[model samples]
Target: MSAPAKASADPAAPGERQGTRRRRHKGIAGNALWFWIFVGPFVVGLLIFSYLPIIWSLVLSFFEAYNTATPSKFVGLRNYVDMLTDHNFLSSLGTFTIFAVFIVPLTFVLALALALLVNQVKIARAFFRSVFFLPTACSYVVASLIWKLSIFNGVRFGLANTVLGWFGIENIAWLSTVDPPWYWIPLVTVRLWLQLGFYMILFIAGLQRISPTLYEAAYVDGAKPGWQVFRYITLPQLRATSVAVLILNLIAAYQAFDEFYNLVGNVNYARPPLVYLYSISLGSIQDLGHGSAGALILAVIIMIVTLLQNRIFGFGKAGD
Candidate 1:
């Protein structure tokens, strides 16, 4: 009773608190409105374009759908069975597997080497980066055309053949010859050129994120200046980036279509799954069910491979 009035009992204090709460609520509502304004379109677009297509494709894979205007009949797993037994589909899978085996390691090593080289440069770093990365900006279709018609053309005067001529070697048909599958040379080279710069940039970003103090500590412990430092420190730090690059490279290799389609034209020797599926679904007699089934199978294979890679790499683990 004799004590001074408490601060909480002040007449103005409750009104001030209420005013502050009102301001906070208004601020939160305004922020929420802005967030939805910015993000709503993207969410709507993803649902309509990406997720919906995936769902529809899954549904279509179960039916006996063709290119005709007639309604599709449900044939359950027949399309999937046909895809499994199809010779062309099997050949395409084999072709893609071989391509992946070659391209994955080649790109990984070359990209890492280029990244290391570029990272050590003391001048014109941006210029060097741009030069390496410029090819990636070129369309696959355009690049394939250049490689096919200009560089590896079967004629005696083609760029590759001309270079061989200078060395007293006979002109080679780089694309059409299948006795030894010489087409692989141009395909591999073009893919390497197109993708090397991208992976190099990724590695460079990974390198930059590595703490310099680790290198300093290694030096203090009498570590050597070159391979030892990289072997013991740099490589370990790049594990995550390496995993990502490998996975991406694998998927890209599996999905390879533009280069093969443009370079080989109508040849059936080097077709990948997508090319085969395209012929099935849209070429001649269209079979949308078989195409959808093959697509889902390819998607499953990619998913399984990626998961296995992640498990092997221990990706997402705290120390990894």
Candidate 2:
């Protein structure tokens, strides 16, 4: 009977599968269109405003671009060659190094101390955090002016000088004195105050992430208050955060300009590399090529230092 005349096979089955496949393709295409539509503006903005300018600056560094309407002449590395021998460039580099040495360690310690205190406190937490972070909210320029004129001013009207008189320590030249003492004290002090709050916040975030169980474990292990869990448990766990703080502090120290400018006003003694670059770029007649070259060099130095930090600290590694 041939299986009672084989039932007619369903013809719509293959068509239904094909229709479902088309729907999936359409859905994927729609999602892709939406993604590009959303991200396109940001991508274009970065290309036009951020990266394009950097590219042009690098190109300008290669050619002799006049500050005026004068045409850019291709000088083929003359700028780079001259910057290598410039006395001012050398001086600025040395000064920045000295500043970094003092600023980085000091800021880290101050921030750590502030974080520990805030973490240990049980009351008025919001008030303490706000009080500490208030300075960071102010613009660097405003803060620098206050420190320069109001706090570190050498005159009798200055707050510090008034307090010094009460202690019989005499008037201290907070800005003008050369190295060993005057060079760093005021700058470091102000920088420490301004930076400690931000880093304290970072450390607070990191500390809060640590399990209370670890502290309890340390206590059970008889870890002393001063002799502390930091060296053992805390340090190991917070290694990544410590690296971040160090890298940030290092970059801040190197790029230090606002405080130097507001307080020292492009004077040689208090100038960092950035301040020197600004002066040459805007103020000098003969050194525009050299100035551009100096800036590129400074940029290179900063990049190298940042890369070194990443390498040593394993900052960008997956686990880190």
Candidate 3:
């Protein structure tokens, strides 16, 4: 009778353990259900809106789609062939290349300089920072329009012309001529004004993160305040930030469309890749096939460049 009672008690203990496991499993299942409830909509939306379009466009690139919903035929790589050989397309690429080369370094230098200056300001720093960063909130289209209509317009009353007139220079049509390529002035300045503050903010953050004790130690070892301290301590410490800024600058340069389009408006000169591809979508050249091919090519190029930069720079890692 004692053995039977003891065995019956042992059976209850096993049942209790099994019951606890079932409760734990139920709790886990309930938590998982809530997690899916939160994240499922966003994931589904992304797939529908973003990923599906990308995949569809890729398939569209392979077909002879000409201003139609359904593709006419599978033309293989002919669209890509035509896109690569296009004169307007080639020239647009050249324009992008030149713009990237000039703007990347210029923005980097100017942003770094502004960062250094702003980082040193002890009083009214927030005021100066806000003033500089306010331009970033302005639309590129608005800025481009302002530059075109008020600042760099060919009229003598234009700000740039008025300033130049003081030096006895005649009013020049900034966006009307390809001979002098003066359109680049407005294009470059508007972009710089819009973007510089953002990069400056980044550099400022990078600067703030540097330990003050390093500078103190350098001072104790007879390192002077200006270039010596900057070159050895500041510059070296900012390598990661520099790489990030340069990568961003390069991508921004290549993706430039709003300023160029708003400023020039289908002009023969200085048309970027986006402008050329867009032109293909409108007005006498509505070949959707080739345009899709060009877009994919540009996308691939951007992806490749980004990957290369990441591989070379080793972002978020310890630098040599």
Q: Estimate each model's TM-score.
A: 0.89, 0.84, 0.87
Worst 10 residues of 2 by lDDT: 3-12
Give me the runs in candidate 1 sitting further than 4 Å from their true place.
1-27, 68-70, 318-320
lDDT of 3 by residue, 171-267 (tens): 9999886778888888899999999999999999989989999999999999999999999999988988999998899989988999999999887
Please write out the lDDT profile of model 1 over residues 80-112, one tens digit for every residue: 999999998999999998999899999999999
* lDDT comparing candidate 2 with the true structure: 0.80
**Scored by CA lDDT, what does every candidate get?**
0.90, 0.80, 0.89
Error of 3 at 255 (Å): 0.9
Of the two candidates 2 and 3, the one with more favorable TM-score, higher being better, is: 3
Q: Root-mean-square deviation of each candidate, in angstroms?
A: 5.2, 6.6, 5.6
Model 2 residue runs over 4 Å out of place are 1-41, 179-183, 284-287, 317-320
Which candidate wins on TM-score? 1
On residues 1-320, what C-alpha lDDT tens digit does candidate 2 reach at each position?
A: 65423322443566656766898999999999999899988999999998886766667667776674233687888889877888887888898998998899888888888887898889999899888878787777888788888888888878999998998887887887775467477788778878889998988888888888988888888997553688787666777778889999998998999888887788876679989988976676534666778888888989999998899888877143
Native-to-model Cα distance after best TM-score fit, residue 58 in candidate 2, in Å = 1.5
Candidate topping lDDT:
1
